[model samples]
Target chain A: MTDELVLRLLARLHGHAGWLAVAALLHPVIVLRSPMRRARGAAWASTLLVSAVAGLGAGLYPSYRALLKQAIFQQNPTVGWWFERKEHLAVGAVTFAWIGLLCHLAAARADSTSQKRLAALAHRAYAAAFFLALSVATIGTIAAANRSF
Target chain B: MTARSALTAASAFAIVPLAYAAQRCVEVGLGGELDPALVPPSPRIALFWRVGVSLVLAAGSTGPFYRLAERSPALALRVAEALAALAFGLLVAQAVFAP
Candidate 1:
């Protein structure tokens, strides 16, 4: 095929792939209960989140595309503009989830003093990282609003 | 929660940066780069890529990372490694190899 034809074909394929990825993602809600399934779900959700952010940033605006794109990240655009606004919301969700996960792990591993100490250290680091992600997300949101992407 | 649990959570959270970076590098190849005259600029795509990475981080944070961190610290690390590899591979495949 010609270069233009190839490009067009690739674009078409990618667009379909994105949608298919979304479809596959939708069928696994039950899997979230299993750690392994949740892992895959989370991965797919993250991938969708990336896809949604790209759509919004590209001037896709608030259409079905945008809604579908946002769904790719995970639900929760109801709190506020930033929280439920767009892709940035994922940061908050991820941070919260990580903290909860850490707590669970620590609770399970509390049999050892050394393990407890490590858990404490992990908590500090996780909190710091979550804050950093939120800060970056906030900055990105500001930039997106002002910069005209 | 105990110290070890906290650490596991922290490790899960800490992996975000690496995952985010991996997504950005690859997604840019998926047409994040700009020709300036296109309907959307490259910067917009780049920004989208950044947000996308965060989304992935969030999903993992809540679902996979959280579960892994809670269930097994070692598995959590493995998950991070797997994610990094997946992100890197996506970048290479989509940006580096795809037409």
Candidate 2:
């Protein structure tokens, strides 16, 4: 298949995955609040979703730079900058989701007192991830709408 | 939680901001031409540095951190939390301020 076609497919999947990541990240934020809640499943889902989105973004990036980036900058420099910051925050969103996943897994193995602490930490981490991913998704949507390949 | 797992998580979390900060510093310090391919795009290395530094740090930090965790779990947790807070602050500052 052609590179353009590949990038288009990746762009489509990335857009869908970005939204899925935002939604998946919210699950542990709510679910892991209770001391009894493990949330391992939701935690893993969010991590995978965000990671997948990031991976897809990586695959699409070269094409993005060659094709859409200059055009977007020409249209609106502000949105172009927003896209830059969004990429940075996307790093945070994906990384925090990973941290939350590790924490959730550790929480499952820990003793009761330690488990609660770890789960609470995971809850906060997931919340942070959710907010960042949400911001990334919103900015990304605007950027794509403004100019996409 | 095991020390190894805790440290791995901490390393992964801490590296995110550290990687970006390093990448930014190198971009600014080394060359002005490579500032993320804005308009009159000349030869740019910003994307290469960004991806390369992040990959290296994320891959390299876990082993040393695991050793640290083995020595002192309390210290490891405290350091990780501090680093995570720093990471959060860095994100906000960059989002609001980066050109």
Index of the highest-TM-score prediction: 2
Model 2 lDDT tens row, A109-132: 765655666676677778888998
Off by over 4 Å in 1: A1-109, A137-141, A144-149, B1-17, B27-32, B35-37, B40-99
**Each prediction's whole-model lDDT (CA):** 0.41, 0.74
User: What DockQ, between 0 and 1, does each candidate earn?
Assistant: 0.14, 0.44
Candidate 2: chain B TM-score equals: 0.68
Question: Model 1, range A1-149, lDDT digits (tens) per residue?
Answer: 77546544543443444344334333332333332222333434533543453443344433323333244223322222232232333333344334434433553445443444333433332333233334435544443333221
| Cα displacement (Å) at residue A63, model 1 | 5.6
Compute the DockQ of candidate 2: 0.44
What TM-score does the A-chain of candidate 1 achieve? Answer: 0.31
Error of 1 at B95 (Å): 19
Count of clashes, each model? 12, 0
